[model samples]
Target: MAAVGVGAFALALAATWTSGPLATGIGAAASAVYALVADLLQPSQRVHAPGGALLRTAAGRVPRFGRLDRPELAGVHPADGPGDRRAPPPYVERDAEPSVRRALEDGGFVLIVGESTAGKTRLAYEVARSRFPRHAFVRPMDRSALAPAVAVARRRRRAVLWLDDLENYLGADGVTAPMVDELLGRRPGRVVILATMRSEEFRRYDAREESRLTGSDRDAWRVQRDVLNAAVKIRLERHWSEAEQLRAAAHREDPRIRLALESGDRFGLAEVVAAGPELLTAWQNAWAPGANPRGAAVVAAAVDCRRSGLRRPVSREWLQDLHRPYLAERGGPDLQPEPFAEAMAWACQAAYATSGLLIGNYSQGYTAFDYVLTASDLPPVPDHLWDALLALVEPADAYDMGLVAHQAGRLPRAAAALERARAGGAAEADFLLAIVTGDRGRPRHAARDLLRVVERRRAALGAAHPETLAAVHQWAFFTGESGEARAASAAFVRLVADATAALGAEHTDTLAARHQQAYFAGEAGEVDTAVRELAALLDVRLRRAEADHPQALAVRRSLIWFSSLRGDLAEAERELRLLLTDAERALGPHNPHTLAIRSTQAAFAAQAGRTEEAIAEFTRLVSERSRLLGHDHPHVTHSRLQRVQGLIAVGRGAEARGELTEILEEARRVLEPGHRHLVLARSLLAPPRHEP
Candidate 1:
């Protein structure tokens, strides 16, 4: 509005220098030009993030190793830092540092994989800081902030997406393949994605075959696999190598390194130097004899809370309430527990003149030392702890805990926590609850839940908001899962249009909607339309992302099936063979996509009348998929069916009938009533002989 006024004023000023009709015409043209230029002058606004280092060079915030505070190191907390004590030691370079720096310098996703306190975060931060010292640094607190953080980094030109402890940003509504592709492809070398993950967490995402997962695990892993695959992974060993220890010996001038060296080759140099084992030992010893058993219980409660995904610090009052069950479980009054004040003091006492079992003061509340979580052999989180945590933790914390529980396969507990979170007005819980509901095999219920969430989100956050759009996307998926393929296809059509308008035609979300649109279109029997749509989408994805990118590969996979359905079986088989080569080269022979393509090729061969060759191929594919994804997985079922068909073709009807009977029984139990596989298996089974 202000720009329009200024444009009018400019028009009037210009008109004063001209004459009559020409003056009026010139002024009008000048006015239009002024307004157009004003509209084009809009610049990128710097959005403020509450946490993480904002190392924007334009603002003079440059990142230095220690002087500029790094994101809290992997194990060390703010309360555990070297304050009065001399700086622990100069950083001994890890073996993976060169590879890490190389990845950072090249500007793409770089993941440092290691166990806790193996110095994943430290290695990533140091390498990133050294490489991109002046670039903006963004560390989103959770998955919710990821897209916005990426946007901020994009605007800053040179930036780093710092994802320390990468688990917090994974799973549903988390970072995925397309997001990474856009970030890396759009800006190229202007930005870098630096992340750290625990070795176990990385392994969970590194699934060789998608059939190994079912329901929500399958859905989540599909995206996670692509994202992890895109990353240049650098592994850091928990125990330092002999060369690393010898290098640490040179730094023994620092007493911490000298002390750590005295432990021989048993532990990581950083783990020992950071007092991780000592703090854990101190906490455990507090449980023995007449020591602070009550205090140990309090710390144990805190650790369990942390393990349960409560990232925020808890109050002493809440800890007091939570610790009682632990105290009672460990012999109750017979343990001769100390007074609350005395116990609190003992638990807070520092170990090795460094960190205490539980860190933080009264003001900040208390958090269990992070190292204790990595080092200890704690049991599964008890029901009492889950019950108490849901009751005491805030809605946001409960939401986080719910996600962790859902990821850990504790569905009932996850549902309960997510329900509490929803009741407390945590909007994200609604979408997650819908996913959890679907995971529990209640697709109709899940669709209804998502419908409500979509309506509410649209009303509250506007129809164009990403969260609302995401809810709509999931609701469409659940609608399809509930057997409403036509409705889901229609939903994706509208979503594609809306997402294109809001997030641009080339945006990942828009492309994702297009992919889904093609899928449901095929499912709804519009195979020709699906083929055209997927082919176009694949072209766009190939232009933007690498040819080997997951989205592109997925589009090609769908297109092949649709093409086959369109009666271009020979062409489809040839395309599938080409796709198999690319899949094997990019994703490995054992990857789900590669295996699926091979299975399809074998099926095509059986259809093409090469029974002997197809039988052998199906035999191997079935065995491999069964081993990876389990015998009951849909992929295995499909392969076994193909093999049975091969047996029938080769005049082994009796053998085929026996296998078909077993498959029909298994399908009846594992598949939905209307599932195509179940229908196929039942149809293939011959009727029992009528003994008149």
Candidate 2:
């Protein structure tokens, strides 16, 4: 018991530290004196030993540790999780098996932690088969039914909770959230918790979870800490010894292969051991006939929605559309219904892989990783990623793929893919196209899409539904951008009223609508109203949000612009400098918001006749933006044009003309024909192209 208990929670050992010394050993007389002292000094000094054969006690008998060395564990193949029809044959006992079994014996919670695909699930299966024949596997996607699941498990002779992906479960169904509480509430030997957590998710588990705790949740918080502290943590490593690798392949003729694979940094072998040489691809082939179209579509959708360290939601409808062509087989002259069983089989396999990329729901799909697992594991993006995406995805799924490109600002790729989507009966892609239109500097065109989005949502959902109101608010905001300031102001005024009444005034969406309404007042020639409303809003924003919140910084930018308009150059300059410094610190110098501020500062300098200073600032802005957002991007071109203006202001019109010609030519090639920057550049080239 002692040998198996190595590194079993340091806190437990610490608790026992003074107890031995405190219990003075005259057997009876000294023990009585010690008891009296303990009662006087520490009323809470009672230590309950864990339930184990070893009397650590106030515990039930500790279960015996079964034999855990190689003989029982070794097999030629991989093991299956619960209910697997053909779990690969169990392999040589993982070194982790003993700890897992021992941890379960002492019974509270055991976390099997490891990197993605690092054999955590495989080890778990071995532990479950050897120890717990009846256990409940709790998953995040099935969380709504979690209470019934635990209730069912608790009915059994020996209930074991098999929880995997603890991080996702933190915010899942009700029972899953009270996981630690439930574990501690149970009698130790009566129930045991076996769980696995990806190391990265586990590292951030507290951040995602702890914030939800209210001030009134002190007891829950304490129990959570105690549960985590009491958990027997087994961290699985990716390394395998030369002997083990060779022995794993003992039936093979290759002698040197195992040695080479076991050598330095062979991450590939970990994937092989965990899922096979083609971990993810193997599933596709294995489930091909059963899930011909469904699984592939799900995989593609997941691939398209990859985000960084955050799960992106994908709709089930989009996945269904992708699955259509394969199901119906129109080209084959036969219209057939989708094979419900086949699609379901794939869905089950995908969602149930010990730590699969996707977690399925009837209405949606979720990836535990922000990016597709395979793409994330690859080398850094090559220069031609756009080309790669276009080549990799099918034409039918191109709209979803295009939405990814559009949202990410890959305009050229976004344009092509979106055009394909629009052609393919994907009406939703039109909304994304509108956003792309606005981004490409044709706000009026974007306004049309925004209107459609608002109308469609308003007609389908009620006017006060959050999604409908959100769409309305977006339409309202777009009017100001479309150069309809008076219309924008009126729309926002109505929006602010609607949002404030429906949602509370302090809600983020309401506040934003209020802020934009205030900004629209200025654009509509109500400067005093804009100034007063923005000033009050800025104070509230600064108080409510973080120090450098985007809204507050935007408010500061407005104040500087309006103050500059009122000819308060000194005040405007001072505030702009502070805003620039704070913005740069908060959101790196090359961030789009920070660069916008820089452009504003440079324009202010030029307006103030600080020609050289403006030129210097604009030069740096152009160079930094070109690096941050490619040379042909509108952001860089705008800065380049501003720098050209600064040059012309300093009596370098000849040099300005040269730079202007290059920018205009690039604008002609890369930007929309009537894009604002192109219009600005052409105006600068007109007669009386005087310095600003």
Candidate 3:
């Protein structure tokens, strides 16, 4: 299709030699077509590529486009006008408030979305006002504005990035794509990017690009999706009840009225909001040919539900043919736009609201891009349309769909999609299937699947390929989980050597392989050698990488365990503190990595005879870990065990025994019987025997 576009561009170039309105339009349209294809052909950024020492050392000094153009004072809210100094409006409780607060507190990101009238911006301000009372509310409308905001936030050590109508700035090829990327990529916990966009707009931004992607700069959606997958999504209900309508009318008064009346209140975008969360079908029924704003949405939604990601879009001719029948069935062919073409023209206008386009050309039919509609959506496709499209295309481009679903943590949907991919002979899906299976607690099956990938890729891509080696390493990992520590250990040793020889000693894969080798070696009972090897790896890493680089932090992490295993409690304590400091500095105090290190810090403190401090640390870790990783996760279980040990250490044996009893039951339920923590818990809780 794009090749055809290129050919059309050549014809338009020639036509431009003759000056006329038709020629001008043709030339401009052809250039756009060519540009779209050119954008598609651009290289995908390697976001996951490892950063080296230079980048790490220059972290704080790196160029930043994350700052806000106008940063509000944290200490004081600007008076609206004429000394109308006042408190913000009271927050209306919503289903998403808890989740929004949690995401903000977690120091990650959140995207609030709804229709124009859904109060998305209001929700964002309320959230910030509630959670970040002491920090500035920084909002940026353009990419350039982000840098100043980020700069202030970083300097202050905290700030809320209040981005309203996010699509205006971060949409595909928007002016501030680089700035948005920089803000999202580097800010982490230092600055929280709380952005709002209409769901309709957001859904459209990547609908076309993602569906037809050959690989390109337009893959920003992929990055944004991945980043925001970690973020909390607060989508205001698209369905508006009568009660909500009344509340919006009564409470959301104009800012000017409040200012003149000397009432304390923050200005809101309420007046700009259009009413009605009307169903799409109803909207379409109501729409007429004369300047109907809903035409594009109707078209976008129709395409979303009808087009399969794997197939070429339905041609304009095909759409017209189908739409004619659709209108007839609704008994509304006489509604307003007598001709199907006129209705389609309206659709083109409405579609600008979403990330959708109606491409028309002499040679090809109109096509839809990345719009997706599901049964859950307000404007979901009617069953007849869905059935037609189902027959028209393959179920989906399952692998691509599965990858996106997996990243979004939609496990069941991911599995269903990948199952289709596997049926279609895509080997990549199997690898993710294995991960999904493991997460579902089917380790045996997952291990078998992973091993198959490793063997297959090793033969096809060669042992030296980074992907093949990664598979081997992952297979070895699941091999351990599926119960073969010694074999897995041997495999890791070989992988480390192979990685070093093929990729060079300083390669990220080699470093990761070495780290794995050290752990498995210890598990295989080569504790002394493992300790020495880990210490040696740490030395090499510290020399080559930034002191707090993730790899170096990982190395120190392993050494702390080795130090403990070697019975050097003081050395272990020192390493734990060092690891904790680095982790806190690099990932933030509340980061999962930092929290894990904190647990180890407690264990070290306990072993070093800091009884009171150890108990406090362990208690903190147990509660935090439970909240973060869940109670059944191994990390939480292990932390609990350490807490038990601390109780025993303090001669609170009865309390220790009681805690062990609870842990023993929990271990039996959540862990394998022979699991190290399970075994330890059993021994600790075993009843004392009296001499017979």
Identify the candidate with maximal TM-score: 1
Model 1: lDDT of residue 666? 78
Off by over 4 Å in 1: 1-66, 69-84, 132-163, 168-193, 200-204, 208-231, 450-692
lDDT of 3 by residue, 48-134 (tens): 211111110011332122221111111111122222222333334555667778877866567887654445655566666657666
Give a tens-digit lDDT track for model 1, residues 518-625: 899999999889989988888897777658765577678888888887686888888898898888887788766678778878878887888899999999998997
User: Per-residue CA lDDT of candidate 2, range 1-692, in tens?
Assistant: 43123223322432232222221111112222232233234332342211111111112221121211221111112222233322333354556677888887766778888776566766775776567544333222223334554664465556555555554333212233246556556655767766767665554324223222111111112322334455688988756555545555662333223432453255534454333334355434433444344554444444433321122344344444443443333222232223533443354342332233343333233342211354345332222334444444444346545544543445655667767666666545665666566555566776787798888878898788656666676666666776688898899889878888888887766777877788889988888888888888888887876457655676788767876777778778889899999987776665566777888888888888888998998899878776654577677888898888878777898998888888998788766566679888988877694598
Q: Which 10 consecutive positions of candidate 3 have the poorest summed lDDT?
A: 49-58
Evaluate model 2: give its lDDT. 0.54
How many clashes show up per model?
0, 7, 17
TM-score of each: 0.56, 0.52, 0.45
Clashing pairs in 1: none
- Deviation in angstroms for 663 in model 1? 26
Instruction: Provide the RMSD of all predictions against the true structure, rounded to 1 decimal.
Output: 17.4, 19.2, 18.6
State the displacement of the C-alpha of residue 330, model 1, in Å, after optimal TM-score superposition.
Answer: 0.7
The TM-score ranking, best first, is: 1, 2, 3
